[model samples]
Target: MYDHRKLGRELNLFDTDPLIGAGLPYWLPDGALIRHILEEYIRSVERQAGYRHVYSPVLGKRELYEISGHWSHYSDDMFPPMDLGNEQVVLRPSLCPHHAVMYRSRSHSYRELPLRMAELGGMYRSELSGVLGGLTRVRAIHLNDAHIFCTLDQVADEAQAALEMIRRAYEALGITPTRYRLSLPGPGGKYVADAEKWQRSTALLTDVLERFGLAFEAAEGEAAFYGPKIDVQVTDGAGRESTLSTIQVDFHQPEQFDLHYIGADGAKHRPVMVHRSIIGSVERAVAHLIEQHGGAFPAWLAPTQLAILPISDAELPNAAALARRCAELGLRAEIISAERGSLGARIREVRQVPYQAVIGAKEAADHYVSLRLRDGRRLDPQPDGDVLARIRAFVDAHGTALWDNAARHCPERKS
Candidate 1:
């Protein structure tokens, strides 16, 4: 079985320290690069879809969660509040309350109804040490969270769009959902007191699922404290299932925060909140990706996209020039010196790198590079410009294939 915990350490992706406490793993450089790429990709996708990014403090006043009902419904998983002079604050467990406060900061009209706000924000959970395992169950999380404040009639459409967004993200990231789950409130749970709100929220999510023709199983006791949600479930290499994406319809927060927008009739009306996440948490997403691809990530997502290997010390100058060119194209390239080992040994060392450009004596003299792909395919020596452009194109397209005949249109002849 391919466990991320094993691959993560072997690849130097991340590590945990006793001094930092359990359930909190610090990301190494390569792992941080992968995370940064994913974050940038998500932000661009959300921006094109009209989400306004925002930043909120990681700590919130204790009363904030109380008003959002989290304190009453989900405090067992939260850290104890810290005493700060005349007031108390705690690390936020979720971002919805802070967003609700942002919406209430100013009055709005029907035109701005469906205002989408997004954040790659930080939050904390008080998880037991026994339950903590690698990135899958971390105390500190950076969530790809967003909320859409829309009219009651717009909830269904907004939810459908969110689901589609999640699907697109899954395709690009090479993630396959195990199943769709309609998470609902169950008996003996700390659910919101409003039965009517729960019923309405559940119905909204059900309708959305049915309209999408999605086969979903309604799972009880899995709903968030405030509302029911559509959970996109995926299994890891060990066959352990977990939720990676979610879409939820909430009515309680607007009421608790007293959020309103003037309608076309010029009267106050409560806006329904649609909560969604394309990638639930950066840590979990990376963990799954690690197991899914077995540490061989796609070109764009690969930490070191290209490794420049010099066959001998004579080619170091040429290799350095090629590296500079790659940097100019916004590609992450590293030069592995000949002093490390033999050329063959060096190639094996960076087998995880998607592309390797070998600058040998003859190739350096001709100002060309022999391209080596991770899949063991080698292309004949080509000019530096030609090779770099091809790499850039594949990375930009987020392509899975290292060498696509149609997209790249290079000759099949090998070195």
Candidate 2:
């Protein structure tokens, strides 16, 4: 396991300063790379699943949460509201309610029953000061949040599709099946009072889990206030359980929000809402990555993929040129050519980088460079073109590790 504080400093990922209040984090350039890369992967997965992406404001009128019952059930976890000329606005604690409003943006029909909406929306919540932790539990979070509007009859199939997606993500992350629990709620639970609806939903989820031959642990009443859900829980290096993903079936929201569409019989029908997150929060996932990989990120996700070290100042120009070519190939590159340190010390610093390109007089004479691997293997780099191709292929191999487990398993193939 990695010490988050030490790794954060070593990599310059983030820092907690007196000016940056507790529960709030400031991402450095390196940290932003991880964040943005994660968002891109989530977007790709959503697009593959036929989800229409949407953006919602960071704050909304107080009534939005109130209508979604967040005001009553989760008000304590919310940032206080601001009073603006008799209008009350609050930082959004969740994106589900906003997505609910979007479902009503246009009149929909049975033909559009399963309308999947996805977003990587930023959100804020006010957790107790004592409960806050770096990345794992932060006040600001970006969620791979999504909601699927399906007819009552389509709920089972949609939820199954979501489960499959979740499974694929976990597997790709090298998360062993035993590390997570796919939990569902039971009938007559505190979440919903409708016995028939609860029974049907629970049974549908059970069948899906069994059909996929996926193992899950069912919690009799571990669900959201308005619905039943399947959660992906990971046991941290400290053996503490944390939720990495969630898939909830909301039976009450459609009625509460008055969401409707024309049925086959031309009658009004309510659409079931499936709320899900492949990686519950980007912050938490990064925290997990740190601990899981022990701060030695895989080649693809490393902030600085290759650090170029020119042994002599005379080779600086050549090293710089090679760095530029690597950058053009989409590989993050760093060059160090100062004589303040010995060659051994310079090479030792190679540990800070997952890959290294070493330039020296001998290499320049031979028209080759020394390539250092994370595992201590050294290969002489060939021509610039060959080096670029090798680096590209190495990146391609490591890029798979950067994906959500699901997409990693069922990689997107070109049509």
Candidate with top lDDT is 1
Which portions of model 1 show Cα errors greater than 4 Å? 407-415
Candidate 1 collision pairs: none
lDDT, candidate 1, 66-151, per-residue tens: 99999999899999999999999999999999999999999999998789999999999999989999999999999999999999
Q: What C-alpha lDDT, on a 0 to 100 scale, does residue 102 get in candidate 1?
A: 96
How far is 339's C-alpha from truth in model 1 (Å)?
Answer: 1.3
Native-referenced Cα lDDT, model 1: 0.93
Stretches of model 2 off by over 4 angstroms after superposition: 171-178, 182-192, 338-340, 397-415
Error of 2 at 247 (Å): 1.1
TM-score against truth, every candidate: 0.96, 0.89
The TM-score obtained by model 2 is: 0.89
Residue 14 deviation, candidate 1, in Å? 1.0
